[model samples]
Target: LLLPYLRNKGRSERVFKDRSNPLEVLSEKELLEKFRFPRHAIQQLAFDLEEKLRPETSRNCSIPSLLQICVVKMDFFNISGFPNVIGAIDGTHIRIKAPSTHEPLFVNRKGYHSINVQAICDAKLRVLNCVARWPGSTHDSRNLVNSQIHDAFERGELQGVLLGDSGYPLKPWLLTPFLNPETAAQTLYNTAHAKTRNVIERCFGVLKRRFHCLHGELRMKPERVCNIICACVVLHNLEDQMLEEPALEITEAGDEDGSGHYIRQMIVENIFSA
Candidate 1:
């Protein structure tokens, strides 16, 4: 049912014809009879799988492993002329059903209900960290600031700088592009920053393209939606590590909020200008 549904929704192409697989040609009633499970039971099973596979930083990640990731990403950026870059950070909105309470909080500037999911990805297209509990109304910078990854960086527990876009603040630990590059050096810096930060955009694209549920509206509750998003991210990372092929190619949606624009400009002028 899921396979036929994905193909019908135009999320993926049919891999097998009706003649090749009798199951693929079965009617909905026939399929249901073969499965012998109710719709609600399938949903419950999905939820159980999500809970079992969702990524937990403490359980799935370690300091030594993180340092190894940093070293690999740093080398990748170094070849591109961006020094000490560990990861690319960005946010994408996941559409969800409107909530019963505080509906306005879920409606984003695009006039849709969603959850803003922030993720940091390494050069290898692996999700190093993810935060998916924030409402779509929340700014990307605020979500980052409130995340455990931010606290970790603040405590100097992590090494190297993160490459972000202009929507994020420029800190000693994080680098954002120059808003208006007037000089050749600033132009060069902005070019490098954009090129390096684009990895996160591609990461999101691959994730959404692989998970059709995320590409379309998720009808589940907000909390359940968050769980599904995290579960998908964990699965995406696993697939990337295993070098699995992607199902489709999807473009990324762009977002911009000037939460730390002023501070970013100051850092660019004081440091990058020199």
Candidate 2:
């Protein structure tokens, strides 16, 4: 219901086994009568959230307040060897109307029609950032351009090594697998670091497994899509924050090699020509 839109979409999208839309339970008259929401209230809430989120210092405002809250609230992603721990980044396919003329935007490199949504999440699997306008054809590496990640890195606003699958390349500030070999020693070093970075992967799994709504087509304008995603992430983070569970636990038995470096390296090469 509106509660998911307002509260728990992030932590438990699949909490209800009944897949039927809850709104359908209402009769037609009730739907007509009750579907109306407080538009002024919504507008005021949006304004308040924007005020809390938008910066007074910069005219540039591609970022929204909810996303800004996600960034500021990233105190819980305990990525090893890194700090700030904002999120792990990746892309997902969202079904969309076929482009009227810009067919290439909908046609992904994988030979399908979809919109690519790049997202970042913290350690507890709450989405912290999202970019929705990129065509499905774009590579995750190339997609970073014109993105907040690009600006954040340029501004030195990002401090931690973000976690990702093999689809991203490695940089000093951004973490990825080895692009070239320095040695067996170098390879091991990267593997260990990457294992530490897999929290982002787990974050993706946790969110997707919970929110089946996100797993399907989301028809909305590009900007609204970004807001919907941020709202869900904040809602998810709120759930985790409410829970008293531990953030992460350290284990001491397995070899760092448990996560194959070979697979990770191939991901780096394919995702980034780096």
Candidate 3:
């Protein structure tokens, strides 16, 4: 009787272990399908959660776990060779009903009534900052220039470079690709910049896909529409998991710093030069 009970207990333990250890048996594609993320991402998640899931030794002696810190890894450099890129910034037009007061202001270059939503996102397509108040007629550069984030960057309150397109002016913290590639390094820099900046475009696509309301015209007041857009952005960030604040790399802001040009040149030499 004791021998049969021991065998049954061993079989149950093996079954439980096999059920819990899917990573060991699942292929990369299967892992992605099951977890909605890649194998490495799942591994990273496991690594991040190990401490939080660890058993507490005694009452009141357990270390407080910060589950939010798991999302801090930007890994933007992994996609493109560009270094220190914390965010990618871009503006997308959100179609909305014609406003009664500022109907003309809402008419975009595409001849559609829309709101120009400026968003900055991390490598993982998580929205870091979003501005949905600007009218469709506003230029992308103008919207960014008038935004609080611009002031923050100017004040050196934030760190890491933001990858933008030719529509945005280059700064110490904001990098745009070269229109005319004069040399091999400049060409390489442009290639990396384009690849890196493409993340913001993908981010916008994912956002619109996740929230189908954004694909069609929003039949509401501009103010209400803005609120909806902001809400969507917040939800998108929550889905991706919020990242920790990046460490600041302060730079002097004055007299339209031409240091951007110098910085670009240095990046071309150090990073792009092969």
lDDT for each residue of candidate 1 in 184-243, tens digit (9 for 90 to 100): 667877876787788889899999999999999999889899988988886776566456
Question: Could you estimate the TM-score for every candidate?
Answer: 0.69, 0.56, 0.69
Alpha-carbon deviation at 51 in model 3, angstroms: 27
Q: What is the lDDT of residue 9 in candidate 2?
A: 58
Candidate 1 positional error at 270, Å: 14
Candidate number with the higher lDDT (2 or 3) = 3
Provide the global lDDT of candidate 3 against the true structure: 0.76
Give lDDT tens digits, candidate 3, residues 1-274: 6999888878854343445678888888898888898878777666644532233233423221233222322467777778877678899999998889979999999999999999887777777677888899999998988876788677765656788898888789888889999999899899989988898999999999999999999999998898788777666665555464432211111223488888888899999998
Please give, for residues 1-274, the per-residue lDDT of candidate 2 as tens digits: 5986767655755564867753546555554576553444445555655643443333553333444434433553233333334456777766555655677767776677666777776555655566666777878777766675656654654444455655765444455555675666456645645655565567656666666666666666544555565555445554575674423211100112323455445434443233
What is the lDDT of every predicted structure here? 0.73, 0.54, 0.76
Candidate 3 residue runs with Cα over 4 Å from true position: 1-74, 242-257
Q: What does the lDDT read for residue 186 in candidate 3?
A: 95
C-alpha displacement of 202 in model 3, angstroms?
0.5
Residue 14's lDDT in candidate 1: 55
Candidate 1, residue 215: lDDT: 95
